[model samples]
Target: MAFYTDTIDFTARPAFSNAIRGFFTRIIAAQNRSIDVERMQDLSDAELAQMGLTRDGIVRHVYRDIYYV
Candidate 1:
């Protein structure tokens, strides 16, 4: 007579977990950039000028990494 046993994958799902973590990381980063843009918008023209930034350039400045503008 012969017998067989079933096997299970008890290892951690690093790939799936990493994907989820990456998704949340991107979301948090985007939110932080939005907050930065808002804070920059609240600054005076002179203050923005001191940082070499313009009111119309806030979004571009915050999203420079993702956008080419």
Candidate 2:
């Protein structure tokens, strides 16, 4: 008796979708971060001090939602 085996491969379809999704995700994340930074920067130094934030920490604070988990 003899047994036969076959292998299947997929290319392009999944990778293309993932690449597109990644591109869009990066764009959206950057947009969100930009908006956050702009709003924070618009604040007076006194206001930012009241909030206990600094210009240097803006990126980390903007993306804190992603990092805390």
What does candidate 2's lDDT look like per residue over 1-69, in tens digits? 998769656787899999999999999988978998899989888888888887777667888877762
What C-alpha lDDT values do all the predictions have? 0.91, 0.84
lDDT of 1: 0.91
Please give, for residues 26-50, the per-residue lDDT of candidate 1 as tens digits: 9999999999999999999999999
- Single out the weakest 10-residue window by summed lDDT for candidate 2: 60-69
lDDT accuracy of residue 54 in candidate 1: 84
What clash pairs does model 1 have?
none
Flag regions of model 1 displaced more than 4 Å. Answer: 1-5, 9-12
Q: Give, for candidate 1, the lowest lDDT window spanning 10 residues.
A: 7-16
* lDDT, model 2: 0.84
Using TM-score as the measure, which candidate wins? 1
